[model samples]
Target: MVGFLGLFAHMAVIGVDTLFAVSSLVISNAITRQIKVGIPVWFCFAFGFAFTEWSNVRACWNDGKEGIIAGSAPVFPLLCIKLLLSWMTENKEAFATRTNAGDNTTITTSATSTSSTSQTGDARKAGGDINTNSKTGDTTKTGGEKKKRHLQLVKDNPDLEYVKEKAKEFYRKNGKWPGRPTLQRIAGCRENHARNALRELKGAS
Candidate 1:
């Protein structure tokens, strides 16, 4: 009876650890944009877990003496790997594409608008009509430039269109589009692709 209880305890610990390890790998891979790397990592983790559990069971069969001893040794290492995987996954960027240009564009536009507004006081002091005309021209130019940028982003990422189409089809069939994580599973494309595609679609409509 004591041996049987120990066996059950060993199995429970191994089962929980395996669950955490597998889930960690899945989430980590999804977040890190390392889906390709993640596949092999998952397999390795699976094999490792299986091996550990087999060792524990084997030790248990011989005698209950080894059950806790064999199982405890691997638990810490598996947990540490799981923790590292979580940290790396969280810190890693989802998309590999450089978003610096997009960020710079926003900063530049903001600076330009602030400067223009500062200059507006001088223009208005000189004449109300002149200030109004200048502001209108600036607004028109800014609007045109933003439109061009958005169009370029869409043109460069044609895959975004396919994602949108697929999302719509999924929604029609399933009655709802999958969440970001599930969508990420469909293809290696990051969340940015989905977000950008949605933005473009809304703008077009």
Candidate 2:
């Protein structure tokens, strides 16, 4: 619809030559952009095209007003306003999507941090094989320490499929790639396992 309007506006300005010569080029460019970039970019292009067409039409009409151009009909600026509104609506939708994704990420991060802190406290209370360095006096978790349920050595773990699904779900929600730690927390798997699964999932994608 936008393309048709743009072509019509351009036709009114540049005559039939643009309709024949430029239309094919425009269609090809639109297809390329739609395939490579996305639909949002096309909306941006539509807004720009509408603006350009409106400017040209108004300029021609101005020239006619000053007796500089002959047979230049006055055009209503409603089309440009409508196009501008459409662009604004598209921007708002994009902004809302980003905002939702950011919110999900923030909430997930906060919950993960809190869960980690609680698990660490529980480990300390239960004396889960923490080692204290003699020189630095820093307590470090030992190899036997298990804060979260994870199958590190099980290559054929059934949770691997579940983790992959959750990883994709997280990406869809967050509008970004999930990190190893985030995937581990989401899928309740070991960081290494989550990392490997995410790698495979990304490769397949």
Candidate 3:
């Protein structure tokens, strides 16, 4: 506990935002190792910031000296990485299991359908062909509509990719993602475009 308190004091010397940024990268890296998928670094930073701030506030209440000793500054952020990593690993495994089960079901159904079709030959060929064509046409129409909408979005935000790369670089340097206003200044894009770029970066795969 004394070692942890010393660590927190050192973190305090480094400043809260900077420490949080470093913590975010650490948390993101740890989670990626466990789950094979990384979370947004900004998310980890935000979580650490909130936790540290709350801990500081609570400890400082009633003129308490333990505010700095409460281990919230940087220690909790480091400790929580393990917790978050475990949580992510469990959730990811569960999702993978469910996805694999779904894929197996789909394959089984497809195989059964193929075998039945082979046996029936021409008996249901006309109906099956019609249904297949209808489904194919509907799928094609939906895909085209989606493509058109995506194209319009891209047209509206020509600087999106550029802003996204800049935002990533900012995160790498500062340990936090820039807000829309900062993004605008850095990317030299319009306010609305900056906002859209930030959204795209946050939702990026």
Task: Note the Cα lDDT for every prediction shown.
Answer: 0.65, 0.61, 0.72
TM-score of 3: 0.33
Q: Best TM-score goes to which candidate?
A: 3
- Which tens-of-lDDT digit does each residue in 1-205 have in candidate 1? 2244677977865665667577656755554564544566666666666655665566666556576666556645756765777676666564323466678889999999999998998787779878788999999999999988755544334487677786676667898665665554454356787677556655675
Sorted by lDDT (best first), the order is 3, 1, 2
Instruction: For candidate 2, write residues 88-107 as lDDT tens digits.
Output: 65577688899999999999
Clashes found in each candidate (C-alpha, N, C closer than 3 A): 0, 0, 0
Scored by lDDT, the top model is 3
- Tens digit per residue, CA lDDT, model 3, 7-41: 78667635755767686667667677763434665
lDDT of 1 at 122: 71
Output the better candidate (2/3) by lDDT.
Answer: 3
Worst 10 residues of 1 by lDDT: 149-158
Which residue ranges in model 2 land beyond 4 Å of their true spot? Answer: 1-158
What is the TM-score of each predicted model, taking all chains together?
Answer: 0.26, 0.25, 0.33
